[model samples]
Target: MTDVMRCEAVADIATPIGHAGRVSSPVAEFDPKRVRRLRRYTWWSVVPMASFYAILVITGLVNGFADGTYAAADLLVLGLVLLVLTVEATRFCASTMRGLGQGRHHGAEQAAAFIAALLTAGCVLATKPEYGFIWVLLPAILAASIVTNATVSLRWPLTFATCGSTAFVVATASWRYGPPMVPIRFALIAAAVVAFTIFVLVVAVWFWDVVLELDRARSVSAELAIAQERLRFAAELHDVQGHHLQAIALKGELAERLVGADDGAARAQAAEVAELARTALRDTREIVHGYRRSDLATELDNAREILEAAGIATTVSGHARSVAPPLQPLFGALVREGATNVLRHSRALHCEMSILTDEHGSEVVLRNDGVYASDGTSGSGIDGLRERFATLGGQVRAEHRDGWFELVGRAEEPGRSEA
Candidate 1:
């Protein structure tokens, strides 16, 4: 259950919502497009293993039928055994690819396949002892495939022992029933088949493991980036407020001391304290409102980066200098809010942003396609933006039309502010 939930969470982080683009979390910096590509690679990597398994299993069945020695009853029994083995092999491959547990039922299936392989090999040997060396490779390869995917605790030891035991058994049988050199030849061939099949299985599993590791690393890196950003913000806030707070404390102490000897001096000191407090309050508010770091160009670049990360094609145009210095921060806020809305409220695939300044005012227009059904409903973020823009005689408009959503914010020049 835990593994299933983890896979689902990774999928949520790496798969775009609605097959468009909707991020799981704004801070999770993953590209669903890249993840999807990796998924394709993982799928293709398993194809060779499945193909080889099928060919080997089919070869065993073909050789058994073409032997021309077995009676009808013997052939029928051989066919049934091979059929069971093929079905079990198919189930194991499907279960492994689908990430299903190799539980007791799987153990039972593996045992059954092992028994079927042994029975089929016995049938081949009993009918045509001379052909046993060639036909025995089939069961060896199949057992290797099953062992490679097994999750049993002692699987490695078990695999080595099983392969070694099979080689010895085949060699002993060959010696007992065939030419003297046949035992060594059959033993070497069995060992080689086991080794080659294990190699192929390991390579397939490695490719999938790499894909999963990449998926995990993507989420971890995103979380680390957010943590670093938060630390940086906290440090900046401390720098801004720490100095003013210390000075305010000293002034308050001095004012208390002066009150005993000189009322006028105490009053002036108190006034200084009040002014210091107000200055600190203003600086704190500026920090909170993003005035200290609200460069319109930076915000635009950030928006583009975020949208592209979410698999959205984003284009940001125009320069920060195009807007009046006083209105730059407002426009920056607009870009940030607009990009955030596109990520959180819509499944946008492409976004366009344009910032401009003219004789009349400064304006920014943001547009995106794949607007969600509820996109036009104003949220608290948009409401706050409207209030901020209104303070400078500006307005922000958001609307959805023709399957596109647009946000436009404009603030008039100081000359036209009163009018």
Candidate 2:
């Protein structure tokens, strides 16, 4: 349960909200995407780990064969231990590829591997005194594998196992060979082997984490990109609909007021309202056709019109056409979002916009002092705009202060990092 929860938490951090639930589950059925991701992860993580364990098994067997000190029974015993280790090592690899103890237990499996390690170490100790060091190498490698593959925390147990195995190997070497010389030489050997094994295992774990984190980061980037596209589309849609809807509402009301005064004037006003509606429909189609990403110059004009209709005093300065070509989309979205926010949220009748460009880059500041209900920050639109400008080393900030709300965004000049 803890492992499951832990994996889920990591997935949540790495995956996007829309796909978090489906992708986070280790127990999830294999789809093409999941399989592809897992395969890539395993290629780098599990394959190298398996190679490390294989080396131990092969080296241990070679040591046993080359040293002709064992009887037939002893040889059989060594072979039996080697067999157990080989199976367990292979099992470790399989389990890793499948998922870290998805349907099985982690601690128990690590314990079992630890015991196999101890058994291998013991066999090496009993066989040949001259080859006592080989025993430490095989078991230490196995210990490293156990440490790397564990799902649950095994820091304390792994510490005990390493310490115990090192001690036992040293003691066995002392008892087999001479006194001071044997113990001193073997203790140093055991300590070296144990330290190297722990280092390999720890580094393996660290590299594994890096791989997972990279994978998670990739997924998040892809999802965030999709989200930004959707938001830009929605914000554009809102701007289209809002601009026309406000026009229709204002013109229809005007026609209503003028109907009793003059038939000709009322008819003309109604005709203009009809023309605006048709223009809105055409604009919506053009927007859908991807005719333009953002039109800052046009949006600024529409903003002033909309705000004035809403009885809000508006002061707009700075020419959008003067902004660098690359920055049109960013400032375009900004103006559209700024207009929507001012007309919808502010209860006061004052707004000020200033678009400035200089050495640093382009900047847009939209401020309004009114009955500030919310922070007046752009929702998904902000994220989309931020992403666009960030490519050019830009940033965005929103502030509500002193009975006033402010949104300030700036993008740096490309290739001017030295400045």
Candidate 3:
């Protein structure tokens, strides 16, 4: 019964780990939309607020020293400070929303920040009427926001729109208030267009890379969850079914012997069989309720039982230690699968199971003295096993050589535990 329980436990542990192996690539699980939204918020809030504060401070210093617009500068400073506070508030709110997985509201927050920055630029233009060239800052901020929010290909067009707008506004302001030189005006516009375009592209690419990284992290988290679930189900099935099946088999044998020989004995055997069946039914119900996994030690014990049941002389040797609780299922599944393959495919008389911790990871190996087909051909089962191991960042090797078939797997130490 203990042996049966062990087999079940091993089975339970391996399921989720095997499943995780199937969906292991971090890239595959990334959500592009989430990354894009985060980029949009970060760029819109950080860049504009920083740029506005820098320009406001510089303009205020010039007015205080050279011109008697200190009062005007003071008002501008207050307004700009308020705008900075608004930007910070929006950033804080957006981060909170993101933490709660509310990505949809990110764009709205970004737009709000943009509007605040634009308002600050408007106030500056009104206060320092002579420094109207600073109005060019608004279009530059819009262009930077666009590049940060959108993809690389759209950057050029967004930059051009910003530069063209800035140039038109600055040119009109100059023509109205002061003398404008065609050569110098064109040169200034051209320089702003070129410089802002490069700036937008560089910042966009940087933010886009950040988005990709976030996507990768999200993908890995999803894969981990999936692997855990698979391990859990595997453990439950192994525990419930393993004991039930053995009990049924034992009772069935006893019933066969007692049949027709003695009525009382036969009736007793029948009762035993009935009880075993009921127990199995109840266990099945419990399994169906939910799947929970056992630790690695439990799984190793289970593997030994499973191999022994197959008439394979099995031995397990290792210091009893705990693995990450979530990973226990994965390791257990690998052992179960290895044992199953030995029983089902290989005509093996002897099997050996060993676990050891190395510098890199914990290694589990199963070896059988069996006659397997010489050709390297994998059926559905082998393919599935391969996929399972791959997801766990482990490798599986099966070789049939010199009347011995061996299967080996490794699992790395997890940084944290999962409940």
- Give all TM-scores, in the order shown: 0.69, 0.52, 0.40
RMSD (Cα, Å) of candidate 1? 7.9
Model 3 clash tally?
15
Query: What are the per-residue Cα lDDT tens digits for candidate 3 across 229-252?
Result: 556677767877898788878877
Q: Which pairs of residues have clashing backbones in candidate 1?
A: none
Q: lDDT for every model? A: 0.65, 0.60, 0.54
- Residue 288 alpha-carbon offset, candidate 3, angstroms: 12
Supply the global lDDT for candidate 1. 0.65
Tens-digit per-residue lDDT, 313-413, candidate 2: 57788877777776766676677667666755666457788889887688988888764655545577667667766777888877787877887889865
User: Which candidate, 1 or 3, has the higher lDDT?
Assistant: 1
**Each model's Cα RMSD:** 7.9, 17.9, 17.8
Q: Supply candidate 2's per-residue lDDT for 160.
A: 64
Worst 10 residues of 2 by lDDT: 1-10
Off by over 4 Å in 1: 1-35, 59-159, 169-177, 302-315, 336-383, 393-419
Where in model 2 is the C-alpha error above 4 Å?
1-68, 93-105, 150-157, 293-419
Q: What lDDT tens digits, residue by residue, belong to model 1 across residues 114-157?
A: 65665556456645674555545456555655665666565677
Which numbered prediction scores highest in lDDT against the true structure? 1
Instruction: Report the candidate with higher TM-score, 2 versus 3.
Output: 2
Winning model by TM-score: 1
